[model samples]
Target: MFDSLNGNQLKKESVMLKKASIALMIVFLMVSVCSARVVDGVDMPETLQVGDAILVLNGVGTRTIAFVIKPYVGGLYLKNAETDAKKIMMADETMAIRLNIISSTGRGTMMNALRKGLRSSLDAMGGDFEMIRTRFDAFQEFFPEDKFEEGNFVDFAYLPGEGLKVYKNDGFVGLIEGIDFKQAFFGIWLNEPSPADSDLKTAMIAGDVSGEARAAQGQWLAKVDLEQEKKAAEAEAAALAKAAAEARAKEEAEQKRLAEEKAKAEAEAKKLAAAKPAPAKPVPAAAPAKAAAPAAATAVATMPAAANNALVAAFLVNAIKTSEQIAVQQGKPFDADAETRRILDMWSKIKAEVAK
Candidate 1:
């Protein structure tokens, strides 16, 4: 009976240890699964407890909103709709939501409507602005009287009730009510002459000739004065012609003087030739006995072997000196003795061949 009691106590202790090991394994598995999962917007692991706050991603396209959780709300609330509801119940979660994008077509329609409303408002103002009136006056002043029709000036004068319309680039600017020729002249600083008023047209045409047109006519007269300049040019040309005649006369005189001098030189040359003495013909004569005697004495004096060699040496030396003198005159240097010997050898060989 005591052994049976001890065995039952050992079995109960073994079962308790097994239960503890299973509980530890289940805790480790839970931890491992929580650590492996990533919470993107929350920036925390799924291991977050029920009280831990975290962020979450929301919105579309490139935009995102981060929502923070309170102690009651956690990253686990994003797991499902039921958890989301629990998060809403537990904490106040505000989201930065974006409105829809506005398209170009919608913007264009709005801009057109704004422009139309602005134009209507401006028109309702009756153009009382001083700047607008001044601009209109400037535009009306731009159109001159010559631009109007032939009988329009008369019509404008007769119909004083009619308004004068002003335009800029063919766009309506404003109107000038009740204007006369004098008022128009005051505005534009020019008189509008009517065709029906012949006296005014004649006076205007004549006055134009007296005013700015007179200055233009004066310029024309100045141009006509250029014709008178031709007389001065002709006078200058005539003076040149007289000077040329004098120059021609002077040149002829110089030519005549040169001809006279040349003729005189030729006459003097002819006179000198006629007066010169004739050259006498040279006649061959026999050499004197004294000259022959001296040549014989020279030959006899050079007859000895040493004397002949000395004579030949002296002759060669003289020949070399002459050749060196010629070389010096030609801007060159020559070896006197060597050149003389070379020339003597060449002469000797030529003489020997001739003799053979």
Candidate 2:
């Protein structure tokens, strides 16, 4: 009894020890997880007015951050903050202007996050992130102005062999030898020329050149010749219509000829059907022969054995011929005589009974 009691106490102690060890392990794991460091920093104003510098724990390793002073809520506000802070502030003020720092680390982190998020979002949106970046880059290069506005007309003329001339108000601004508008606006940074000054230059040189003498001459000649060409096209169309009508009439005559031939063939088929003999009917069983006459004698009297055998053979041949006719009618070819001979041999055994 004492030994059993001691064994029970030992088991209880073992279980308690296991629970304590498990609890200690769990605590250690939680502490280790809590001690890990993440990317942590404070959000501060990105830009400051003249003589104003905001101190921010710069995750990008920048010491001082500058900001532009802008009016907000009837008071002066600073612009050019970190993206996170800007997003939070802009959530309330929809019309607020914010400047992006565009640093290497900042852009990289933001772009990585954007890519990860867009992988799922892009499927729903039906576009790729790479395409979105490419389009954004193109938009920045093409139209650099903050807001688009209408400008005066600028005349750009390309000579036959000479370079292109840009004009504003009858004054020549510049000459371009080989410039492509699509490449200038849509090409990558390494290949495309800067467009910052191009817009301004184009705006200044608007409405400069008069119409070219050669261009005016070509336009007038094209207009006069176009009317004459239209009249010629109408005459040609009329001639074509007459020829088409003649061809249609010929086609109708040919169709009528084919119809008459088909009717004649059908009538010949009906005449042949009428001339063909009808199939022979099977004979009914004869009444019992006279009592005095033997069965064999009576059979011989009703039909000669040789002739009866021949008639059975003929009937079998007719059956095979009918089968062949059915196959032929169904667009299949068959050997009628070979099948008829096969049927005669098969019915030879039954010929004696049939003759009787």
Candidate 3:
């Protein structure tokens, strides 16, 4: 191809190619510097005009679920580029947040997400609960449609003095008046607790729309924290169980000690009783009073020694019966019945010997 061109023709062709190359470079630079960011296949403009205020795109992020479901692409537009989320939320200047619904999101689902975010935002702001609730209730009416399908645009533009204006698919929804509401509403994404997705929050703050926020590892640390909490709970439970077991063991040991003390006391009592001397048996009482005193004396004088012994034994038996009654009333630990039987047997033997 070069051989077909003459020397002059080659020079002209070379100049044309250089000019074309420079123009292409200029075009590329312009496009790079002023191009719209594409996030999750949604085009986010570099600048947004809201109520005569021009806001620049600070960043773009995609709201994802488990790193798989991409619901919407959120673009943050501010008066100036900012990396700090707190500053952005606190600033009262004109700013706008654009949400391009890339998937089917129902009105209920969107409102629920907003409610969670706003709650966190309001809590962070520490504003009046009733006032914030009132504003939030009014804000709920902004999303009157049942569902915001794919290719829908939801824009929340905050004007410093006028409050926050909402638009659904470029159609005006409603306005909620209050800087307090704005602080809480934006805090859903910029707040520390993260009402929606933390990874998306980071991306929006960083001004990058690389889809890295949707990565699986984005929530890895959260999972790690949960696992750590679970382990701590299990450890606490195990410690409680061990404490209970130890208490039971201690109780059982004390009970065993008490039982041993009781048995030892009983044994000592038995030993003391065994070592003590036995009491003498009682003598029998005299015969019945039906006999006269002189006759009793004569009978005693004429009676054999065995008969006298029987008479004493009878008296002893009568004494023992009275003592048994006293012992019963006093709750004494004495065998009164056995002692009576022994005395009776002795008397009978004495009587029988006397007759023989």
Candidate 4:
């Protein structure tokens, strides 16, 4: 039905449709990007200037209610990627943390978590909680505006000589003075004890650096220790190999002795049989002389039994001699009672092979 349309008309329509679609995609991506700071949902700037010092986004994380309810988007900002939390805490360089409030409940809950994190950090630093009690009491003055509501952004900016600068929605709030305060407050999110905020710390350390670069910085000591462990393992393996070789040699000697004993027993049995005088008897007229055959059959039947006894005797002697040494290879004391029956069974198989 549309074949009647001009070629130019069709081309123009197609171009308009493509442009509209592209426009819509751009709008969606913009909305998504804004909602998610840095990425989507983490509202953070690549470089946020604090006083005279310009800082880069270290990482972005979300603080949730019961791990599901969205509360606030937290961001850690530093000069660059820093895997070590201690360096962040000790570094007098400018760094900032932002908590972008997403919900009304973020005020009380998120703040409480922050306070608890700071206290835990303080405890880790070995400071008396009461000594810093007043610092926190005075620190509560920043929240006086009752507008700790949604869409509010709070920043904790640290300057070397001036201490921490608190800001709300871009307006200057107040200052929490002292180097000790910075260590404890930063530690809350940067160190342990804040399981909920650990993700934020991780994101900050990761920054935009490659994984290999971060691992190199993080695992230098561990790599040194790993080399030591490898050397120790090699030495232990060489010792075990030496012990196993000695065991095999001892086992070979025992087997040779057993074979010699079996030969000796067989020879001695045959000699004794030959030395014994045969009793003479008159043969019956009807019966064929089978006396020589009976004697030969008797010797053959007894040969297997004698060989079996010799093998069993040799195995037992070896077991007794090597039990303690075998235990050393096992890295424990040898249990003679448990192994005796097993050795006997093995001896029986060897004897059976000889009989066959």
TM-scores, in order shown? 0.20, 0.19, 0.48, 0.46
Q: Judge candidate 2 against the unseen true structure and give its global Cα lDDT, from 0 to 1.
A: 0.36
Best by TM-score: 3
Query: Which pairs of residues clash in candidate 4, taking residues 3 or more apart in a chain or in different chains?
Result: 36-40, 36-41, 36-42, 37-42, 37-43, 58-204
Between candidates 1 and 2, the TM-score winner: 1
The collision pairs in model 1 are none
Candidate 1 Cα errors over 4 Å, as ranges: 1-224, 283-356
For model 2, where is the 10-residue window of minimal lDDT? Answer: 70-79
Worst 10 residues of 3 by lDDT: 209-218
Global lDDT of each candidate: 0.36, 0.36, 0.72, 0.65
Worst 10 residues of 4 by lDDT: 291-300
lDDT (Cα) of model 3 = 0.72
Best by lDDT: 3
Candidate 3 residue-wise lDDT, 1-356, digit = tens: 22233344445545554554555454444333335678778888777668755567778889998879888999888766689899999899898899999999888988888887777777777755566887788888777679988998989999989999999877888999988888888888898765578888887788543332222122333344444554555555455556656667887899999999999999999999999999989989977766223222333343345447676766665656555665566667557666566555655666787789
Predicted candidate 4 versus true structure: per-residue lDDT over 1-356, tens digit per residue: 12223334445545554554555454444322112244334446655668755456667777655667777777777766777877887688789988887776634655677677877887777776677678787787778655468777889999989989999888998898888888888888776644346666677666664343333323432433444454454555455555556667887899999999999999999999999998989776786644332222222333335546676466465654465554565566666655565555555665678779
TM-score, candidate number 4: 0.46
lDDT of 2 by residue, 303-324 (tens): 3246566775555555665666
* C-alpha root-mean-square deviation, each candidate: 46.7, 36.8, 29.5, 37.1
